[model samples]
Target: MQLSVLDQSVAVTGRTEDASIRETLTLARHCEALGYRRFWVSEHHSHPTIVGSAPEVLMAAIAATTSRIRVGSAGVMLPHYAALKVAEQFRVLEAIAPGRIDLGVGRAPGSDMRTARLLSSDPRQSADNFPIQVRELQAWLAGVDLPEGHPGRGVTANPMGPSAPEMWMLGSSDYGAQLAAHYGLPYAFAYFITDGQGAGQALDLYRANYRPSPRHPAPQAVLCVWALAADTEAEAWHHFSGRERWKIDRNRGALAALPSPEEVALRPYTPAEQMEADKLRANAFVGSGPQVAAKLRALANTLEVEELVVITWAHDPAARRRSYELLAREFF
Candidate 1:
């Protein structure tokens, strides 16, 4: 299986948000050295926990700092901006790192409804236009003429070159699967977002309905999963306490920075909260390097996906880096 990374630039308690962004850059270079296939960043607008709001901007920084690793957005929220604008930005990124950019796009707001409205140029813009936007973006990125009668038929994305970003459809639902299959583009299921719910159904739908396109003659699917690995199984669970507590609190509408394991240990969990935490831990991939690798292999086999995009969150940035490092050693 091909291993990749999807970093959310997670904010941690007692650290400035800027530090989180810098850590993502550092992690990208680190992952490259570890022989990972790709390093993708995420987009989340005005989010307290996930601070990676501008994936295009972050992609540029990562491209400049890393040589071999493929850099791209886990996605740019398609509904939030103009298709041509996104295409142009990615085209420029391709110019910087030809044949190494992957343009993953999605329809989700990536923020609260109100914040989404602020990001949209047209206040009345509907996500229903996402398919149309993706079609236009695909044409622009490929330097092909838009179909007749289209409003952006004549306009072009600037800095057109021999290479273009590889476009991938990203989502946590069936709608994205159907759309991706229709376009014959690569699809990445957000297994982390829904905690594996609906993943099998979505991937099944994608491959079944996939149409052949020039760039991708066959269906290409990726699973983005949340996992953590440590030197030992017990140590791994100890660090997992922070993420477990955060998940429980997040379900109750709390969007705080990731707390340290020490902080989480100091506070006692209610029985109800403990139950929720246990559920999360049970479903999570947390253990020593070999153990996590075994679980990852089993998941890939069950899902029939060749590529696994791992995303890890920890209070200490070093731990996050170590998680990826250990996984890379096990796989690569």
Candidate 2:
């Protein structure tokens, strides 16, 4: 099995953005030493808790910091930028680190509508043209000519290299899965966000409708999930509590920085909030080292996926790093 990481550079309640980003670099090195295959950063906009608004820039930093781990985006939101620009940016990355970059693209805005407008001139129009944009991006990356009379037929993304970055389509729903299958691209399902529901159906649909292309001759799938591990089950839950509260805040449209475990423990929760938290907890794999390994194995078996991209959310950097350390020791 191949294990990878998806880091959002989440801000701790009392830490600076710089501290969060520094920890990201440190975690990249840590995961690389632990034998992780890939290190992917996420893209978010106007989110107080998330500092990873520009995944390509952060990916470059991670690539510069670590030598072995493949660095890429969990996804760059395709609706916010020109397809040629996206291809050019990733081409430059591939030039710097050949055969070690992945370009994961998504159709969603990655933010609220207001922020989407800030990032894109015509947010709705851009989203409506997602499929067309994806085709153009593929053409640019492959250095092939678009169809006759296409807008980008003659234009080329300069500095096209010998190889293009491996491309993957990221999605939380079956729409994305079908689209990815149509393009013959690898698909990554956001099991963490969907709480593991409907994943089987989506993956099944992807495989059933997949068509072979030069970029991906066979169907490939990856499950991106939330996970945490520690020496004891109690310690693991202690770290997970903060993330639970953060999820509740997100549900309530309150995007606060991640609270400390100690802070979460002292708060009084109503029955409704507690119920919501319980539901949110279902999405995470949190336990002692052995228990987490067993659960992950079971999930992989059930989903029929060989690759896992783990996202660990914790208030303290040490706890987050420890979680990965324990999991790596258990799994690798």
Specify the highest-TM-score model's number: 1
Q: Candidate 1 lDDT, tens digit per residue, 217-259?
A: 9999999999999999998998888889888899999988999
Error at 40, model 1, angstroms: 0.6
- What RMSD does model 2 have? 1.3
lDDT of 2 by residue, 1-332 (tens): 77899999999888888788889999999999999999999999988898889999988888877788899898999999999999999988888888899999998988988888899866465788889988999899889999999978999987777888888999999999999999999999999888888899999999999999987889999999999998899999988988888888788888888999889878978899989977766656999988988888899999999999999989988888988988888778
TM-score of every model versus the real structure: 0.99, 0.97
> Runs in model 1 with CA error above 4 Å?
none
User: Which residue pairs show backbone clashes in model 2?
Assistant: none
Which runs in model 2 stand beyond 4 Å of their true positions? 122-124
Best-fitting candidate, scored by lDDT: 1
